[model samples]
Target: MKKRYLASALVLFSIGSLFVGVSAISPLEVFDLTEDQLHILTASRFPRLISILLAGASISVCGLIMQQLTRNKFVSPTTAGTMDSARLGVLVSLMIFTSASPLQKMSIAFIFALLGTFVFMKILDRIKFKDVIFVPLVGLMFGNIISSITTFFAYKNDLIQNMSAWMQGDFSLIVSGRYELMYISIPVMILAYIFANKFTIAGMGEDFSTSLGLNYRTVVNLGLIIVAFVASSVLLTVGMIPFLGLIIPNIVSIYQGDHLKKNLPHTALLGALFVLVCDIIGRVVIYPYELPISLTVGVIGSGIFAYLLIRRKAYEV
Candidate 1:
């Protein structure tokens, strides 16, 4: 499994290294490159590729962390109300912090994302079913409630058009200045890797972790903080990218087993590959124009979601 993921990661990096822009210049051209080609690659294509890879890996790892903490394979920001809460936070920023800087708006979104995740955890604690399947359903319902409120406010303020622009994920807008915020996910992902053992222990149920002298609650809180930060960063940078989180982790665990440390690298690599493939497709499918990544991933991810639903026994983590 490790070899498989390493190979996939190499392939993804190689493909990304080769592909240059709408111009589609070759690597040989890159070595003997003209000034114009160098500028295009350095200023535009490189940054966009970096952003896509980071967003994919970060979000997928976030999902894996959320699943481990909750002991629910289905729980993720997309399914667990985190992204919706972040979106609501963005909307609130637009309303109250009308004159706020981008950093300020992202700060507001991060706060709401943390609160929403806390609320979802509380709901997870209270739920009777406590099954992996039930958790996401509850999360979906919770997200819908939050989404409805956001839509209402958007309509009332005549900002629905603006809100819609950001509601879907589009990689085309990711140039040098706009996509740097995604770098925030890198350190947060490193934090998750650092605390991987604690997360694994916490996933073994609270009582077992307590018996082993682990501060289960603190570990859980730390995990949630990482998840919230990654989700909000991605949401604010690329708009809401659905299903990359939920799907990538499950796929990784299929061959990697449930060990968080063992799976983290694979999850990150596969997540980046999956998103890059989707983004590349979105670019070519419509030619001169482009499809939003959210739409492209949504369609493919929905199919994967249904397959996971049908093959539930195969994904018991």
Candidate 2:
């Protein structure tokens, strides 16, 4: 959990990711690279690495912010309908704006994701029953409903193949020309860092934040917008990587404590490290073939999630 250790691991994994694919770009040959090697390095491997780091860091930070604002360790974009709604928005873009560019599709996805997150918050406010676990379950069910609607329309329009492309997280498709939109997350992450202290205040509850001269509602909304945009952009670019956000932040908080400002950097580093490791495993587990990121993360992340739930319950008892 030490920053240096996490940074060290991140650097090692990043360098490893650069050399892992079936392209035969060995570190040993880098000093005497061929023309095709250089092109592959510049075009494919580096872009995939960058997209992986950005998606991992931004999504984890997004989850950390949401957990703080909502006071639920379990809440994240995956559970909150944000990703599903964004996928629906993608379908809408393809259906209505057939000639829409990727950026335009992302714009539509961002709007729907924001609206979906807003609706989740509204429902959160009205719920008379509030169990830490149950709240996110509600969110998961809501997300499923949106996913079902997306699926229904996808089947009707014969766009299931298109829509399914974004359902699973895969890095195989990312290359230099295709992944620039994920860069949007860099500035959004900066905004999160700037507002970190206010987010901490907002997490302390509305009355407490108001007493301290903060506009609690504004800060919460700002956090949601950050989550929505990051989630949408990542989905637009790399597809849905479930539980990266939820698990990474919780792991950071356990070791680093709950102060949003203090833990942001650690969360970012650990998130990137986790994704890099998972991605490398995905690449090598089958040797020359790969697993989709969604599968690897879902398989591993769900186990960690289950353990966390049991641990939390034990401590509460």
Candidate 3:
């Protein structure tokens, strides 16, 4: 949880991620590398590693923002219909824009993801019951409905195969030219850090923010826009990596406390470290073969989610 320890872990795993693939590259080979090895390092390894780090850090920070705005630790893109709606937007893009560019596709996805998240927030406003756990359950149901609609349309239009590719998160296909879209997350993350204090104030509740002369609605909307963009960008680039956002922030808050500004750095570092470690395990568990990141993260994240739920329940009792 300390900055020094987290930084050390991030550096170690990032370096390890660079060398764990099918390519036979080593740290010592850095000084003298053949053309083939250099190509492998630059074309595949480096890009994949960069995507993993950005996707992990960006999504986890987005999760922290959502939790702050919603005042619930469990809310994230995964549970809040953001990712599902982004996938739906992707399907719509494939159907309408046969030759859509990456940026165009991401734009559409961002719009839909934002809309879905906004609708969920509206529902939250209307509900009188503010159960800690039930709000996200409703969000889950909403996302499932959107996913079902996307699947139905995908089947009718025969785009199910293409849609399936974006259903799971995998970095195996990442190459230098293919993964540049993920860079969009870098600026979004910076903006998140910049607005950290406002988000902290916003999370204290709208009435509290109003008392402090903050424009609560504007801050909340800005936070959602950030979440939507990051969710859309990652979905467009790497597909859905469930619970990376949800669990990482919660874990960070456990050690770092609930202040968004204080917790941001740890959340980002831990998220990247978690993904890098999972990706390495996926690469080696069946040598020369690979497991998709979604599966690996899903298995581990779901276990952590269950534990968190149990802990929350125990506290209630």
Q: Candidate 2: list runs displaced more than 4 Å.
A: none
lDDT of 1 at 10: 52
TM-score of 2: 0.99
User: Residue-wise lDDT of candidate 1 within 1-317, one digit each (tens)?
Assistant: 67575666657664664473477678667668888777777777878888888998999999999989888888889898999998999999999889988788888888898999999999888988887677899999999999999999999998898788668998787777888888989899999999999999999989999999999999999998898888888888888888888988888887878999989988898888888888877877877677899999999999998898778866454
TM-score of each prediction: 0.94, 0.99, 0.98
Clashing pairs in 3: none
In candidate 1, position 295 carries an lDDT of 93
True lDDT of residue 153, candidate 3: 99
Segments of candidate 1 deviating more than 4 angstroms? 3-20, 313-317
lDDT against true structure, model 2: 0.94
TM-score of 1: 0.94
Local accuracy of candidate 2 as per-residue lDDT tens digits, 130-210: 799999999999999999999999999999999999999999999999999999999999999999999999999999999
The regions of model 3 sitting more than 4 angstroms off are none
lDDT of 3 at 85: 96
- Number of clashes in every candidate structure? 0, 0, 0
* Per-model RMSD to reference: 2.1, 0.8, 0.8
Q: Residue 284 CA error for candidate 1 (Å)?
A: 1.6
Candidate 3, residue 193: how far the Cα is off, in Å: 1.0
Of 1 and 3, the candidate ahead on TM-score is 3
For all candidates in order, the CA lDDT equals: 0.86, 0.94, 0.94
